[model samples]
Structure formats: structure tokens, C-alpha cells
Target: MKMTKRNGVFAVVLAGMIWTFASCSKDDDTIPANIEGNAIEVAQASTIAKPGTTVSVALSFADPGNGTMLVIHRDEAPLRSVPLQDGQTSYTFEDILPADLEEGDVVPYAFFIADEKNTITSDASAFEVSVALYDEITIGSSPVYQIELPEDGIIETGKVKLAAGRKYWLPHSVHFMSGTELQMEAGVELYMNTETGETYDVVIDEGARVDVTGTATAPVVVTSDKLLRDQDAEPGDWGQFNIKGEGNGSSSGHVEYLRVEYAGDRGFRLQGVGSGTTINYVQAYRALGEGIMPTDGDVRMKYLVATNCEGGGFRFGDAYAGYVQFAISQTTSFYDEVEAFTIRETASPVISNVTVVGPGEDVDDTHGMRLRANSSGKVYNSIVADFPRRGLRLNDKVTVTDLQGSTVFAYSYIFNVPRDPYRDDTENGNPFRGYLDAENVFQNPFFNNVTGFEDNDEDEPILATIDGIGTTSYIPQTVKNSAFNPASIHAFFSEANYVGAVSEAAADWTKGWVRDYEGNIHQ
Candidate 1:
């Protein structure tokens, strides 16, 4: 059963259909399963979208048969019910969003399911319909709403939601004090304050939460208003979005599909974070400093991309131990020394399936990776290429000792390094130069079209260009791999055996969602 409240985003243009399931025969003559107590879970959801945006969802569940039912609730009111046949599991909901919805107004929906025994479970999230977001409005401008913050700039009391359909400009840095929540809906974009040319930081204090989640199609963008006017805007217009935790600061964060642009010099910094956080599908472009910096603690995630960012791609340090996979980091500067991955101070993160496009041959100072401070992380089935200096460097004796002992750094390829491909610190005399031999880490691969990625600069996305020089990414036999299936190591990671982030078969993941340097978005 599909409920039409406020002519919602599920308007007539949505393929002329609503929630359709082969098992859900909601013809009024079928039975109704009265569900309560958070019954059928909303396993997945679509975020609030702009008007005229297409929204699609897929619903699937376990074998909750014995006559199941799904009930849709909007604004805490029971709307409609659908009866389901036993053993039926798949359903699809696709629709065009209503065009008249306003920003800041939430359309909270709940889905409850009832089993044969009538036991029920449910889940939900707020969905707001919004419109145009402008930087500045003159007299007689369109009726767009603006978020009003307290003069003190500390939201210490209740929840503050920066919904879609409105322009948001924080006059100053805002802090979500303890026990407060700063929620952002889908299609919500916030302008980082750049009035005084100082960094604009959003602090998620201890015991505070910040859920800045956007949908796959309508992502949440955190950029300055300058980009709206000038596509080729300079980066570093703002500062850090800091999530602080002092050795266990219980501050939680759920950031997905978020694009942080022109905000670096510490773009997104994290410390003392744990497994309770959720970070995926995140990007940092043209950052002034480290794109994503987690100096300490177990900060982990997947599907991260850092493009042309300054400082480095990801800087992990201070006893950090985490897991990362399916990541891409790139830079092409000749004067600025930028490392794709910088690890120091006992930070050891298990990383795999990454494609790092290093600085070109003109640069001679930066390595593709720098591991020091006794870091003991592992690298598996990845590609690190085009580095001018050493491909992989061990900055100290403690790091080399750990690599020879408990740390794992094997099953990856290092190519196009002009100088010493593998070398230790000069003070260490580079004596252990042959430690990372070609058997475990090699030099070349049958790259399909890796002409420094300049081959497909016009018609293709650079992230999707790391395809195998041949049919694959020159990966060895599936069993000759020291790379273990990532799923076995952690439940959060997907089962992966591929060598690099983008392969011949899986090269389209970066097609049409993220934004480019010119401020153009793919549909």
C-alpha cells in the first residue's frame, strides 16, 4: 500500500507506480497485519530529496513468513497496510518526489512488519522535501528559508536539523554541546563561513552526535558559497570539521556521501574515535592540508576518495589501528610534496584495494607511502604507482623492525618510481634496501591504459580509469595472494580479492555521483 501525504515526492512522474511487491497484494480484499512495537524494520531508506528528484528503494528481508504484513506510517500516523504471501521477499518502491514540499519540515515515515506470531519491528528516518539554496538574497528574492542559530553559536539544548530547500550560512563556528544532535537531511548543503578568511570548524563535543548523512543520489555537500558563483574556486576557504574524543569521548558521527570541498588545512580531523562511528562514500577535494586526518584511535571506513588535495590524502598517526579498503587518492603537483598515504607515530591501519596516483616524475621529494614511528599496519592487493621518490619508505629503525616482525606489507605492486623504489632512511644507510623484494611487492603490471591517466581526461572519470592494463589489475593467482578475504577480517568490510580499488570489472563505481574540480556534478 502506498500512502500519499502532502502529494509527497512520490508524485505521478515516478514511473507511474508506487511500492510494488510480487507478494504484496494490497487489494483491500486481502488481510491486514496489525503491526506495532517497531515491527517491520526499515532496513534501508532514501533520504529527503529536492523537488522533481527521482527516488527509488528496494526492500528485502529474511524469511519472516507465516503471513507477513508491512505497514507504512507517516508523521506517527497509521497510513496504509499491505498483506504479503509467505516466502515472498523482494519489493521495489520508486517514485518522483512531490514538488511542493518545504525545507525544514520533516516527513518521518516508519515501516513495521508483523510475523506469523504478530511480533513486530520497525525503523524510520525523517525525509524533508526542499528547494533552492542561495548564497545571498537581495530584496524581492524567492521565498527561501534560512537557518537561525543562537547568538552564542552553541546548540546546547535541543536538536537542530539543517534541512533541504534552504540556504544555510553559519555566521560563526557552531558547537553541538554534549547530549545535543546536529542532523542534516538529504539534499542539504551547508556553506562554510569564510567571512574573516579563518577556518570554520564544526565541533562535535563529548557526548554530542552529528548525523550528516545524505542519500546516494542526493549527497550532502559542505562547501563555501563561492563555488556556486565561480566553478574554478580556490580551496582552503574554510577550516576543519573536527570530531573530538579524548581517549574515548563518546561523540558519535554518521557521515555518508558527504563532499567536503575547499575546506582543508585539516579538512576533517578525527581523534579517539572507535567502531561505533559510520563513515562511507566520503570525498575531500582540493584540500589545503590533509584531506582526511585521523591522528589517533581506531578510525576506519571504506569508499574514500581524495583528489588533488594538499598536505596528503590520509594522514593516520598516534597509535591508530583501523581497516580501510576501496579507496582512491591522487595528486599531480610538482612543487608541493604530497604523499598518497602518510602513516606515523605507531598508526597501523590495515589497508587494501587502493589506487594511489602519486605526484609525477618532476617531483623528487615525496614518497608514495611513508611509514614510521613503529607502525605495524598491513597492505594487501593494492597498487601504488608513479611516485618520484621511493615507492615505500620506512622512516626509522623501529618501523623496519616491525615490518620484518609482526607487520605485513606484501601482495601489492609499486611502479614508475624514478629514484630508489624501496629504501630505508639515509641515516640507516639504506642497508635493508632489498627487504621489500619483487616476490612480495613487484614493479610492473599489464595496465590497460595507465598513461598517467591523461589518456581519458576528457570523456572519462579519473577514478574509474585505474582499470587493469590488460584484462585485470595484474593480480596474481587467487591462492598466491597473501591478501586474505577482507570480509573474514572484519564484518564491516566487503568480501574483496581484487588488487586495486577500481578493476576492469568493477570500474564504474565513480561514475555519476561525486563532483569534479570544476564544481560540475554527474547525474
Candidate 2:
């Protein structure tokens, strides 16, 4: 089974040639009535240019009368039009191009004109050209037995053990084959790195079974080495740690008790056709896009957590027939916690066991979760809170079951407590229509310590400054009276079955798994 996403770029360079007619276009005079010439079409503009290089464009034009001026625009921004100087009756547009292209692609623009007095514009044209010169990062084509820290390596086409303090860079279609143990010891980081190819497919494909396992006591950490620049990292600076499989391989690719942080897009973009690949106890934090984006496959996840993401807590797009259990997602600026999960012309997903929390006000592009058109799925045991738009939205043809014991609706206690009124105020277009089973309750499913879960907020332009919870100051004393303490938040649960994501566990629950940033088991 082979799926190929082609990145084809079409660049149009329009050239216009205008000329003065001897007489009005008619049958009376011997001169031709109209001027026939090529119009300049500029397709793409503003390509990143390498420091020392130029992009040239081949231009063709037809002219009956006199030569015309050609004006070109580069990049998407505004451009100053220039004349295409013509010496002879016929015109050709190929010439010396602009030097000093920025480090990337140099998209060119060329405008053409026949007569200066007469105004004529050509169709817009766009093209993408590469000029950036990055040192080729080639990991020896051979496979290695074990890997170590600050080390550069590659896996071409077989099973490789990624022991402690090791990192691997994957080229397209490289498989991690089933039975591979990509283990990271406690405090160790497994950095998956990739460079942008000439194609728009910025997502590097592993095309193989993946096993990223770590333990809580020394939780396996997977991140981009670029994050070494700062203790705290930003999103989208690197590429995705993609694990690709047709989901037809051995059911051995399992990720447990691991923390994947600072991925360029989604923390884990898992697409394995096989049914056995499982991802559980995963946490994605400070992600630029979706925390977990599953496409055309299924992933079994438990105790998954994500924070400070722009897309959603978790997004299952395409035909991702999977089961998600004990999941929690919280933030302010994501598009939606869980979305329709489809971008193709027609594609839907099956998602279950979700908990989403976000600021309610829909200022910029804030949304909770949406089931888009022509998509179908079942949602059970989920709590959506304080979304700017609809809490739970049902758009197209979808069947949702509000299981008696598994669902909750309009629960005032869980909905009313958020300081961000946008989260609790339901008057806004309520998005949870499909899941509103009559058995679902709309009361405050009270927690043990409601006030303690309040997290810290810094005055930065982005997310909060606090790490885990508690403390306005470094000292041991409780910082603020209203601050939400992470330690106290989990303990606050009083009810039997939890409403949203977090839940109170048995005294031995901590032993089940080690907790990471999103509160997922690291071990």
C-alpha cells in the first residue's frame, strides 16, 4: 500500500506587449486592427533566496506592432512594475535576472507592456525556486546497533535500537520495522530531526513502525535539539517526528510512558495501516499545532495530555479508527480541542474518550471541538469546557451517543468554575447538540478542590509562566490564594466518575504510571 502526496508548484510569468496603432482597428486601413502579444503572468512571489544566488525565468511573448515593456513582481508583497524594453519589432523576455536571492526559494515576476501610454496588464503568474544552501545532513547510509547523545545517525531500511541519549534523523520512507526498540532512558531525549526538502512536503515521513518507550522514574524524553537554546521552547521550529506504517506490520510498535515535546507540527503524526501499533501514556506540551494528529490509521492512547497548542488538544483526521482513553487537553489559543479531523474533499474519523478545556471567548479563531460536514463518529466520556465558540459542535451527518454513565452535559459545577467566563457561559452558540442525550446531566459535577487547579499566568505575549502548578514564588509556601495547584487539582475530585479529563485515582494509581507535564504516565 503506497500513498504519495505530490507537491507540484505551478509558476506563471505573464508578459504583455502593447503597440500604437496607425489607425482605429477597422477594415478601412491596411494596418492590423488589434495587437496580438503574450501577456505576462506572475504565479508565485517572495521566495526565500539564498545569500548568493539569482533566479532566472524564461519568458516568451508575441508582438505584431512595436515591442512592449515587461514589469515583474516577486513574492506575494507589492511590487514596482518595470517596462520590458523592446529594440526590434519582435520581443523575447529572457535576460539577466536579479542576484542576492534570500536563503530559500526565489520566486520571480516579469511584467510586459507594448505601449507606454496604453495600459495593459498580464495574468498573474507564480513559481517556487530553491536557492537556500544548507549543509547536507547525511547520516551514514548504514544502520547502527545503538545510538548516543549529541550523535548524528540514520536508519535506512531496517530495525535499529535507539538506546539512551540517542537521536535519529529519518529520510523519506525509512521504516523502523516491527520489533524495533527505540528506547530512551530516564532524563534522556530522543530528538527526531529532518530538513526541509525541495518539495512542499515539510513533513518528513518515517514510513516505518516506531517504538518510542520511556519510564517515569527516568522518563524517555523526545524533542528537537534546537530546544537546547532555551529551557523553555517554542513550537514549529523543527520538523515532525513522523512514524509511518501501513498499520499492517507486526503489532509491536508501542509508545508508552514517554514525553514528546516541541515538535514542529503535531507531537506525533502516527499513520500506520496496521491495527497493533499502540501509543499510550503520551504527553505533548507547548506544541505549535495539534498535540496528536492521527491520519488514516488507529492509535490506542490512555492518559494523554497536551497544553499551549494552536490547533487542538488532539485531532484525529481522515479514517483514524482508534480508541482514546483518559485524555485531557487545556489551553486558550487552539482552533479546537478535537476537530472534524478531515481536510480532504471527503474524509471522517472515529474518536472516543476526550476531555477539552479552553477559554470561552471566541476572539481570534478560538473553537472547542467541531464535527464537520459529511463526517461521522461517536463521542463518549468527554467534557468540553469554556470554549470561545460552541462547546461541542455537530455539523454534517453524525451519530453521537450520550451514554448514561459515560457522558455529562450542562454540568454547572464543571462549567461554572472557570475564571475565563468564555468557558462557562453557554448562551453562545452551544456546539454540543448531538451528544445531548436526555440522561446526561447539566449540573456542576463538583471536584474535591475546585480552587486549587487554577494555574499561574505570566504577563508574556503567549502562554503562562508556571511549569506544573502551585507557587507564585519559588518558596514552599502557597503563592496565591486563588492559584490552581496541580498537586491539589487531582486530589480535589470527589465524584466517582470524573466529568472532564482529570480524575482522582486510587491510592496506588501513581504506581500505575509516572506523571509528566500533561499528567500522562512517563514510564
Candidate 3:
């Protein structure tokens, strides 16, 4: 398929300009000066100069003796010498600085008078220069900066590996045809340029594969170019990583230690990929659409985090049967129609050890989990807290019979949900009226930190907070004595001893792999 070209040569020019500005520096240390005396005076010099601006320095001497040469030195190197005849009292040296000099660069210049027998130098003067910063798009070893795959043959056959610490720019959408495989080493970054006002998607067509293997020290990053420097860039600046078609059940295609930010669409759209496709340690932030949407795929996900997404954090459809563990979705809004998990079309997923937090009572029409349209799932040993509305919702089509036989929500903790913990939309009946069993805890989860809670008396019991949770501000953690205890349900979940996604004593897995809105790199 042919990709659409948005803007013309200006986009290309902007890319070149970014590179030029990033590499240019004004470290030239050469200028001439003229003065011969223990107390030589010079006119006041400009303390600051912007790039592309001219700065002048004037020197005055007590005695302009004949045959006195004016020498200017910059950074201890002689720049130029001018002949000063008798009656010459002051000489001005002017130079225009390059436009690409970055900020915080101090250019030093000194005035000096030199003759065949004597040399006199003045104290060094400095001018701090400032230059505007630009976001850069680096194209690695690819044959062309932007590529369009043909419709017929297998493109990028064996493996196209992106090196570590390198960046690649995608000016337009790229379609990876069948049988092509792409790999990215740790610390590799992929940037999408949206200055052209056209969205771009990285499409992995049927049978195509992509493997992003990163470590905790060097995780891979995929984000819009604006996010590199512009703090105001919102979500939906660019498209997403679309992986289409079912794979060959090989473990070769997987994603690990990757962070995707400001995706205009879904951060990851996987269709028909089987359970062998591993997704671990992945974080999606500020997604305009669903953070991760899967259709007809049985994928296993672990250590996944989604925050501030307008759409659902994990949206599944069309018979997706997957296992998710240690997943956390925090600070999602109901006004944006967001939910921690949205399941439909008979999808049955097993979720455990998850923590879902929502914007408090002011938000409406939101829920922690929306299970509807013949969907059946099991949620075990998890924490759902602070949702403005219902913690879990069962639509009109779901009945008590379907919930009892096909779905299981046990050994979990639900707290601070302003609305009903369980809601059913059956015509006249409340099918989920007595579903909260002994195994489940409806009292306060007692998180170490809580913010933005409404002062209403209805939420008073869960308002009390503790202090042991480390670094618990926007994201909360539970201490050892907290209410969450995975060991309480050891038979169902034996791997973890904590109920929530994070524990105070254990190392936080989200650290060193996630990036927040403030551009702070976690860990």
C-alpha cells in the first residue's frame, strides 16, 4: 500500500535544521585587543548574546602611543591584530555569532596591546549565548530515511536490527509485508514526526514480526517527536504500532522493556497473534485511544502499566483469552470514557495481582471494569479502588447464570468505589446483589497514599491513610501490614505474596522503564 505524503520539502528542511542546531557550538577562542598599561579600561560589554546576533567589544587605552598594535584574544587564542596609530583612543571589534549555538555557552574574549618589546592583557570578559532547542529525528543505517514496502514480496527478510542508543524517524506510515522481521536493541528510540499534520502507523502485516528486547538499564522508547522537548504535546500526536495477523506460534516475536508515549491511536493493536507472543514490562502513557487493544489473540502480558489513557487501558474483543499479571492502571478518567479493562465478544481473560485506580467522585460514567456483551473472565487477588462510579459493571446481556458459571471474581479487594461495587443492567433484577462472597474483601484496601478524594461522608471509612508506602503520591503502594495479602489465596495465586501490583518492600518494577508527563524518566 502507498503511504500518504503530508507536507512537502519543508518537513525535510525542518529535519536538517534540527540536526544542524543540535551539533553547532561557538567555542571559537580568538580575538584581538590593544592596550598597554597596568590599568587599561574597556567599555562595558553586553553580558548576553543570542544566536545570530552580533556582539561588539570596545577597548580604550590611557596612552595611544604610535605603532601600538591592537590584539584581540578569545579563549586565550589570538583572533586578529589591528594597527593603532597615534590619536587612536578606542577601537571596537565586532563579530556575528552563528545561529546554531546552544544555550549556556560562554564565549570569552580578552583585550591586549602588543608591540615588539611589550605585551599588555586585560581581564577576560564573557558573553552567555542562548539558542532555541529543536526536536531531532535521526535516521540510522536504513537505506532511506522513509521507506514504503511493496505489496507482493516479503520486505526486510531476515532481521533488520536497530542499534542501541540510536534513533530512527518515521516521516510517513511504514507497512511491513509478510515474512519481514524487525528487531530493536536496547536503548533504541523511534520517533514519529507529526509536524506535517498527518498521523503515521507502523504496520506489521500478516506473518510479519517485530521483537523489541530491552533491559531495565536500557529500555526502548517509542514516542512522538514533540514529546522530546515540547512539554505541551498531548496524546494522539501520532498513530500506533499495529501488529496484524496470527503468527506461526514462535516465541521470536515479542515485546519487552518498551515504553510508548502519546500515541494518537492505540499504543499496540495486536490482531490474531497467539499466546506465544510475549508482552512484558510494557508501559503506555497518555494514549488517546486504548493503551493495548487485542482482537482474536491469546496473548500473555506481565508487568504492564497504563496511565492517563482516554480509552480503556486494556480493551479486548473477539475471543481473546489471555493471562495478565502485575498490571496497574492509575488516574484514568471517566469523562474520557476510560476503564481499566473493557472486555467484549465472548473474550475470557484471566487477570491477577492488578491495581486499578480512578479519578475520584467528581468524574462520572466510569468504571473499574466493564464486562459486557457475552464476555466472561476471572479476576483474582487484585485491588480495585477509588473509582468514581461502579467498581465492576455487567451489562443487560450478562445474567447471574453467566456470571456464576463462566466468570469468577474472587479473593479480590474492592474499596472506595463511590457507586455500587457490582452493578448489573438486567431489565428489572439486580443479578449481582449478593455476589460479594466471603473470599472477597469490600472494606478499605488501606493504601499508603491517597489524593483527590472527595470529602463526602460516604467515603469516610476508606479515607484513613497510612505512612509506610514509599514514594506514594500519585501512584500508591502497600506496606507489609496493609490489607493486600496474596498469600491469603495461595491456592489460586502462589507466585506473589502481595495483593496489589506493588509492595513497599519489593523492588518496584515500573521504575527505570516508565516516563511521566514531567519528562522524568523513572528508575
Pick by TM-score: which candidate is best? Answer: 1
The candidate maximizing lDDT is 3
lDDT of 3 by residue, 292-391 (tens): 8877767777888877778867787878877777887766345465577777788887777777777765566677877778787766656666677667
lDDT of 2 at 43: 36
- Give candidate 3's TM-score: 0.61
Backbone atom clashes (below 3 Å) for every candidate? 19, 70, 12
Candidate 3 lDDT (Cα, 0 to 1): 0.61
For each candidate in the order shown, give its overall lDDT on alpha carbons.
0.60, 0.42, 0.61
Q: Candidate 1's residue-wise lDDT over 1-523, tens digit each? A: 2223344543332212122221344334233443333233333544545555665555665545657666554544555656777776655545464555443444545454654433343333233232332224421232323456678678888777676434466657788887888887777777765657677777887678778878777777777756544444567888777776544323377887777887768777877776567778888877888888876667577888777677877788887777788887767664266566877878778887776767655565776776777777676666677767676676763443333444555556566665655546635532222222234332112221222222422212122123332111222223223344667667767777656665543344555556643446633
- Per-residue error at 3 for model 1, in Å? 14
lDDT of 2 by residue, 1-523 (tens): 1111113432321321112121222333232223444544333343433344554444455442344454444443324443554443332333233354322234444344424533443343444454432322333442212232212233344443443433333332222433333433334454444344311111223444455566645556655544433334456645455666555432536677776666656766776544577666676666677877766665555667666556666776666555555566666454444431222212343233345666444434455555554445444434554544444444444433332322222221123212232222223322232112254432212211122222222111011111122111111122112112222223322222323334323222224343333434432
Locate the minimum summed-lDDT window of 10 residues in model 2. Answer: 458-467
**Cα error, candidate 1, residue 364 (Å):** 4.9
* TM of each candidate vs. truth: 0.65, 0.47, 0.61
lDDT score, candidate 1, position 297: 61
After the best TM-score superposition of candidate 1, give how far the Cα of residue 269 lies from its true spot, in angstroms.
1.2
Query: Model 3 segments beyond 4 Å from truth?
Result: 1-158, 228-231, 247-252, 332-335, 399-404, 427-494, 517-519
Give, for candidate 1, the lowest lDDT window spanning 10 residues: 13-22
